[model samples]
Target: MLCRILFAVAISLQRVEAVDPLVDVSYTRYQGTSLLNGITQWLGIRYAASPVGALRFQAPQDPPSDSSIQLANEHGLLCLATGASPMDNTTSEDCLFLDVYAPTNATSKSKLPVYFFIQGGAFNANSNANYNGSGLIKASGMNIVVVNFNYRVGPYGFLASKEVLAGGSVNNGLKDQRKALEWMQKYISRFGGDPQHVTMGGDSAGAASIALHLTAYGGRDDGLFHATAAESQSFASMLNVEESQYQYNNLVIRTGCIDEEDTLACLRSLNVTFLQKNNFNTPSPGAQVAPIAMYNPVIDNDLIQDYTYRAFEQGKFLHLPAIFGDDTNEGTIFTPKNTSTIGQSDTFLQSQFPALTFEHLRTINSLYPVAEQYPNSGKFWRQVSNAYGEQRYICPGIFISNAHARDSVSCNWNYHWNVIDPVSAAAGYGVSHTVETSAIWGPENVNGGAPASYSTTNSATVPVAQAYWTSFIRSFNPNTHRLPGTPEWGAWTLDGYQRLLFQTNATAMETVPDDQKKRCAYLSSIGVAIKQ
Candidate 1:
């Protein structure tokens, strides 16, 4: 009779568990609350989407306090679609949620370091949900909390119009970032993260955004992050407002949504499919579907008060330890094979940029030695790389490194990822943009076959890379005796021009000649030297 009773109770419990619609999570400030199933784990707490309706276009309002209803567990709908990237397709406008991945065993007394990742996709592609922080969280060994939040992207996030400005909407994307950081400041401790020991980091456009945040408004809220890691993007390397506005206006015109008096509203009301279909194309010749042209954060007066490079040059980055670097062949990702054949002659070069004299073109070519090395490669590949490198990576990185070096309170370490995957040779490119991300997070989790391309030598390179990165995350210094092997990370100096070069054979130190470095620097300064 007792055995029979236990069996019946087991059946009842199984049925109840199957029918339970939500999961409950308890936070220090809030009591037990049910959340939408999958979303709860991602956030590690219950959170509701902002309820501010039309005020959604305005700065993000605080999440409502609800004691009764279970916050939905599934991921919030991503913001309205801006393009056809994988991130845009999976997300919805209700996507203003933050995921906190902390050490599962951590406690309130455990003050773990925090890594606040800003996702990249030119501010129009990608989302926080796309990143799985489990590897990074575990690799660091420290109680590391990974926070990923959705910020408005595309028109909703970066619309710059007279009406929107009049209505007080400027840099909505940046404002969203600020609010997310503020939320972390107020609540991260509850999840075992040390708000005081926060390290802000990101890749590609995300890295650019971090750079913007650092230089914006006297590095507002300097207390938020103790260190910054900008991967493959920098302020000096990004588009200024003038350049960005031209592309934005072209996109606005192409989308055919100009009929409405309120462009932001019209954009919001349109079906996600229609907006994406009309506006979807690889904007520049070699660019991805969403390149620097289609969508990006603008230098609006409020969020980005001045040119990001100028801010860095003026020593405005709150004197934080900084780690900044780029892939050796960042441009190859976008460069195609046919570009060189099509524009091999001086006639083609001059025709493309009629304003440029033969002398000017030669001067530009002399600076980018890779063009000479692969003269037959293509005009689009060679010339464009030189131009983009100047506008995006080379100049800005050197400038920021120089600035940080001069700012006594700041320590700067620079790297050039020279390790090229032999497998990627099938694609006829060297180490491309975003190749290092797999190493930083770990190899297996990287999407598709992307990580597989990183050769055996490349795979072996992971430990050193991981050690360097986690060391930075743990102490805000990439240099530590803890790193394996004998090579030591040295401070970059204007005189020595020393930078760490990560190659397949070995991780070693090299001193770049001031002249060669200056040539590379001049190439980056082509259009924006005065601006910096």
Candidate 2:
């Protein structure tokens, strides 16, 4: 009787195993020809490689079929890494793939808002695959699809020559973005994502790219995203065609490719290793001598007709909900090697700010005390921080934010993240640029070791940050009262004069006094020309 009972149990277990396979996925053919694989159990999705090869440099072609393939257990390849930064690992010319994460058991009938992210790397470094959307998606209880794909970086992506321009192809990286948006519009429905409620967002150069997209003619027609959140960088600081050409010519000369008739083709034909060894290996400031000389998006008349700053000023941007801001220490990342601290004496300020009168320097120094702390460092960091705050980051942030506020009917939100912690302290940089990225995407999403301070705060603030992001994605306004552990986000106005300040333990909604903000603004008006 015992043996008979055991046999019955074994048979029941076998039947249960057969009913649910190890990899639980549902596949459907999409875009008429391409395989659209959805991992229903895992709640992930990706596209199979397109069959077209040489046509790759051209626009993205439609997938041949709408049929689904089994996607139960595969992660897509990351874009090829071209720079010497320790953060990058995988890369490829054929890395035009994206991934999406949605609620399990969700169908077309259950549409959830989507957050589309564009990764930042100065248009030449980093890949989208490094970021994982699982935590954000799960924590927020929102259907989120994170698209990570490769647009051409370096010579392969952004080469503009007389021949290429005549052929009508410049800013191929931007073109890749357009194609991705097109893909999202046609197929997000399959993954239970709302096609019409997409929020486009990015950081650093990615932020600049979004700003460019907001002003691009093709971007206007893409009809993919309804809202935008640009972080850290803006089009106001973007280099124009003349500026780009000057940099391009210098790079060509540096790389010994000036003699080539077709610079783009020649650069592409060279081994990636040879290019990296000769150009990218060295640590250099600015765009000069960067490994990916030909990789910058150009101001082609068709897509980008004029300077982005000019476009925003002239009200050429799309009338969409927008949120943009920068951190307090944007220039710390690019601080030059020879920079020194300012002395307490009036004589030192005069030398540094030769353009300013002695009285002006005294007034500035009085407001921003340089010699009070770190006397040995000579208040160099403080002065530099103040200068960069006004000229590079604050000026542009305010200008663009104000522009969007005036031009668009949709709401605008501005933030000043002053969450300086021990991690940045360890790095000898305070509230540096790119510090907030881990908070946005979560610690696991970043590549390098985060500061020790990051671990302490991640448990509480990570969820809060993700909520703020997801809420913004679901609704253009980030002012949801439902977010736990934070005050409501308010509309940023020129008159009320407040900025949302994000910290590790608290989120403060405070009005920045006109006097404090204006000092930086005044300093910016003069310092920009001096730095240029």
Candidate 3:
């Protein structure tokens, strides 16, 4: 399979005609291919230098000018991570690279829109190579240029501590993302993309990063991206730098960096292989506690000034026109099997969010009652997914959309991705996190991707989604730039907060008032009160 992928990429690069111009770098003519009929792709272009050696924990630096034409024939290395192993070849520390896909006809003068994407894995897994943008470029009829890059993940990306703060940036991976965006602004026009009209989008962790960018530094707009889209956006709520110091300390002690005068320097100098193995070899997460998920964006009062929902509720975010949503049953997979009893479930919730008081968790648990509250519900843990899902995925969508709506600036649109795939339906995962990404990205390449051939619903949703999204990238309104036959998608308003539900059922795909309102409201109450 690896050989086949490498072959495909190599073939694509070889097919490039000498007549096609190289991308706008001061180096060798890194010519790529017109791989697909109407689209061209330049793969694994480094946006930043290799983050190896002493540069491991530092923020990504700009890709320096080189005289050699760096052949971008294949995907970049998968950034080192733990818990979730590499989906493709060779994980390494030198993984800061991106790929660009555009219409074959595009040129510096074309000014086509840009769609920048980020992949998801709870800050622990996945990579840019896993999500090739061919499907998107094809879906958009080769009219847009799509960008995807690798960012540090797991401990390498998000671990925070006083030592880390005193040394380098917290959330190094997110800063990697920022650097990539800056790269786009500097060079995308060379590939016929309009950097000024860039729209950043993602699923799961990628979506969480998008949300953070929205609120980074009290909603500052550094002209990075004009709009955003997020699926299953993570709203884990920020852990103050000190709040996660225990994780940092544990890592320090385990890695034998403890007692070093310059602990951060010790961490930076440690062997990459040793650090990744130990720090990321976390215990498997139980149904309710995504303990390792805490190794994510920290509240450093810089990139993140406050908790996610708090930033939303308090009206601090980039306020870009955004389209955000979550999956139906977002918690089925995240909900652990061990917490069958209500007591165990409560314990799990408290352990996950230590800041929430027992009294608060108890009241919240009552709202998501166990014991077949709904006539067809099964075990307590099954039902417990309701609260867990609401707390983690579903409500955060509502929270941010509400926050965007309150601004009354951009016409924020929200969505609910309940689209079922054959694989998920077979496993009873039911419209879980990242299901829509497959359809949007097309088939066969991504994890849980659209199959070799799309199903009936995928056929319906793909064009609709691509058209809707690319249209938004072109013009901030999903309705205005819609495909000829695309359905009307309205804005999510504070009073009329409706979501476009993408599902297998025909009627289920239209705009409707959010069904998770009450649960999301309860989540808001807790988040607002506890300030999570």
What is the C-alpha lDDT profile of model 3 across 1-532, one tens digit per residue?
3223322332232122223646756533466777746777888888888887767767888777778676778888778766544333478878888888887777776777789998887777654355777777776656678999889887788878787777776788899999999989988888878777788999888998998898898889899898888888876645777866777787889988888988888888887767766755332223344464657778888888887777777888876778888877787677665556777777666655656776777778777776333223336755666677778878888888888778775568888876667766555456676677766776544645554335554667766676777667656666655667546777788777777877543523344445457767777877845545
Cα-based lDDT at residue 342, candidate 2:
47
The window of 10 residues in a row where model 1 has the poorest summed lDDT is 12-21
Error of 3 at 322 (Å): 1.4
**Could you estimate the TM-score for every candidate?**
0.79, 0.76, 0.89
State which candidate, 1 or 2, has the greater lDDT.
Answer: 1
Tell me how far the alpha carbon of residue 243 in candidate 3 is from the true structure, in angstroms, after superposition.
Answer: 2.2
Off by over 4 Å in 1: 1-56, 68-81, 85-89, 127-129, 235-264, 280-292, 341-362, 369-383, 453-455, 513-516, 527-532
Winner on TM-score (1 vs 3)? 3
Q: Residues 292-359, candidate 1, lDDT per residue (tens digit)?
A: 43445656666777767667767776667777787766656554545654234333333222334456
Question: Candidate 2: deviation at residue 248, Å?
Answer: 4.6
Off by over 4 Å in 3: 1-21, 27-29, 84-89, 281-292, 371-378, 445-448, 451-453, 456-458, 481-486, 505-515, 528-531
lDDT on C-alpha atoms for all candidate structures: 0.60, 0.57, 0.72
TM-score of candidate 3 versus the correct structure, residues matched by position: 0.89
Candidate 2 local Cα displacement, residue 343, angstroms: 14
Model 3 lowest lDDT segment of ten: 9-18
> In what order do the candidates fall by lDDT, top score first?
3, 1, 2
Looking at model 3, the pairs that clash are 28-69, 214-318, 219-317, 287-335, 287-336
